[model samples]
Target: MSRHAFFIAGDRVVHVANPCGAGFQYQAQSHVLSPRAQVGPQQHEAAETVLVVQQGALELMVNGAAGYVPAGSFVRIPAKTWFAYRNVGDVAAFVLCRTAPPQPARGARKITIQIAAA
Candidate 1:
């Protein structure tokens, strides 16, 4: 088995690359969101987040702004910017998420913030 080749298990979210797993400087993950499913309105304290839409569409709310990202498109969320995403299409959506500088070994610190209802 090559260190460069790895398989992600079938899960809602799977870490494909990480310092502990792939010795990467950044962390990469795969997310599968069912129709109408949604993620967090949270922000990373230090790492920047980049999301790539592989299939279906997503409605994104970032720092009080709303945007529609279609398949093949991507969005960047700077550190400390609150963001959330939902699958807008009537199918499963696939997303590839990358976070640079990776997260702290103890995990990211979750902060409480109010996001306007979308």
Candidate 2:
């Protein structure tokens, strides 16, 4: 089951159905990153992260192996694997991100004002 959801957080334009709050364990969001932006060589301790480039292109480096993922391409960052992503394209890159076991929220909290359907 899915429900339409929308929110904006930092530089990410998130638009996806997230069932985490309703008690579903896994979480997902469409992350829209700005052009030339780079996400760190971070590692997930518990949940494995799956990222699929929905639009534009992203250079994904997983455990030192790098590959360019264009729209409709996906890469999996296993738990404890170092990974990063950078949008080399001039346009904004959209990535569909899903994490199993629901990753914990970190840093500042942004108010998620739900967008009402018309």
Candidate 3:
């Protein structure tokens, strides 16, 4: 049996059973954010990301629609879509994010948002 365990605390960390495993499946990972920390407007180019709020509350803005993702709430960001997330709560926010078949062009570019008068 393969031993896969690690400490996941304030300073969140993740340990894969097989670091060099080859597959095209999404993996669930835990993440912790400090107050006011944010991530956004990123495109995977190949993989899709889904964020699930586990402990605290988070402000999620996807494709111009805003929603509050609290514990038990989930948000899915399609591959190559514009999206962002922010922790607006008083305390740190805990979230579980899953990604599929790592994108080859990960972080190579960002999605631009433009606003026009209606």
On TM-score, the candidate that comes out on top is: 1
lDDT of 1: 0.74
lDDT per residue for candidate 2 within 1-118, as digits (tens), equals 1233444444345566665565445666667789999887898788898887778999988889888898877777778889999998999997777776444445424444755444
lDDT of 1 by residue, 22-76 (tens): 4444566778999999999888887898888878999999988899999888788
The count of residue-pair clashes in candidate 3 stands at: 0
Q: Per-residue error at 75 for model 2, in Å?
A: 1.4
Q: What would you estimate as the lDDT of candidate 2?
A: 0.73
Lowest lDDT sum, 10 consecutive residues, model 3, at 1-10
Q: List the residue pairs that clash in candidate 1.
A: none
What's every prediction's RMSD, in angstroms? 12.8, 9.3, 14.1
Candidate 1, residue 79: Cα displacement in angstroms equals 0.5
Using all chains and alpha carbons, the TM-scores for the candidates as numbered come to: 0.68, 0.67, 0.64
Instruction: Report, for every candidate in turn, its global Cα lDDT versus the true structure.
Output: 0.74, 0.73, 0.68
The clash count of every prediction, one per candidate, is: 0, 0, 0
